[model samples]
Target: MASVNTLPGMAPTLAGKTAYVAICGLGMAADLADGLEAAGARVAIITDDTSCFASRSGVEAAFAAVAERVGPADLVVHAAASRALCGAQKLTSFGEAGFRCADTALRATLYALQAAHGQMAGRGGAIVVLGPAMSLVGASNLVPLVTATEGQRALVKSGARQWGRCGITVNWLAAVSELFAAELAGMDPGGPELGEACALGRRPQWAMDIAPVLAFLGSDAGRSITGASINMDGGEWMTP
Candidate 1:
């Protein structure tokens, strides 16, 4: 359980906001929800069911029902991912298994983004998704999942460009795959850093490394920042 230790007067507070976390496979999102709550947003986690994220309509229906049950959201977050890793051709040989690993993540991202647009239309809000750093530096034999994550990055730009007119900010948060228990997909945990020594010489902690960034994105401070990939991997993965 995540504790409710909200900062009284914070700059990035989502005070008076409702953050709808359209969770898929990001390990329950409990702590992340706590961070949103700390920022003063009432957090509602929806849809861990695979079927709910299987298609665009499924995502839309879930969002619609949630809105009716609760209310429209001021922000939406989708950080769907998998811990599994595989080779490209091997996945291809396995058929849907490989594609599922890749397709599911990207498709769910699209579903959440599409549903969020409808839910926050006219009112305006923010949408954020997690994309693996593997999108930049491909992981060994981890092509399918990497493809999906990189596709998500492109979609972030696409969504932001189109939705900016609607007062919506869409951005991608870049993270090391290890954060999602992607041990094989990320830098080897027990060995030296994969490429170069980490500038920070450590991995990112969910609270210390990631939540603050999410808090800022959910706050007024991040309203104008959109369509960009913000790296939060403890300096292990840096991009220009």
Candidate 2:
């Protein structure tokens, strides 16, 4: 669905660098894949909907589709997630069903990350995970999401710590703003002033805004930065 542009003499600078992205939500998967390609990196994608875990076959097909144009290298972004937003009242009143759904997202991401990590360890590459900003604070109406977010942060830290020595750097792309712009399109979206007392009173961010940061973290420039959670949100959410 994405169109490719020819740049006469300007081949991609990051071309031939191969990267596999899994669990891309909505259209962001395709967007990130295309960005990686523009940078000269070969890209392959696998969504959770595929039957075989990370959908290795799907990724292979992507590589084949662009094989003649750009070669492949090494990198993977493991990010499979489902809506785990359960109103706090329900979470506290009911049992585990809601909580389980939320927890599953973290586990799913871990499974995909581990699979990708194996391949990266074999080739020495970078791993990036798409994490949520809700993980940074407690939203009374959204307990399930909060749990999953925090759990993911923990996973990123552990993954980076264990894999850093293997020539693989793992980190979380913590979005300081709402990366889900499409969903908020007709909602008459408001700025941080709406939630000032709760968060740091900052504005939400678009998905495109977060893409560049993710691309940077997955590049060689971010090679030395591992096990760190980089906030892409404005100064809205800060530590005291």
Indicate which candidate wins on lDDT.
Answer: 1
Report how far residue 207 has shifted in candidate 1, in Å.
3.5
Worst 10 residues of 1 by lDDT: 1-10
* Candidate 2 lDDT by residue in tens digits, 110-137: 6666666656655667777776555676
Give a tens-digit lDDT track for model 1, residues 1-240. Answer: 223353333334777888887877656376677767766677777756633587889888888877876688888878765444333344456477767777878888888899999988998899988765656776655667677888888998999999999999998888755565443443354432233456787866554456567767867788999998988766776776
Q: What are the RMSDs of all candidates, in order?
A: 3.4, 5.7
Worst-scoring 10-residue span by lDDT in model 2 = 180-189
Cα distance off (Å), candidate 1, residue 71: 1.9
Number of the top candidate by TM-score?
1
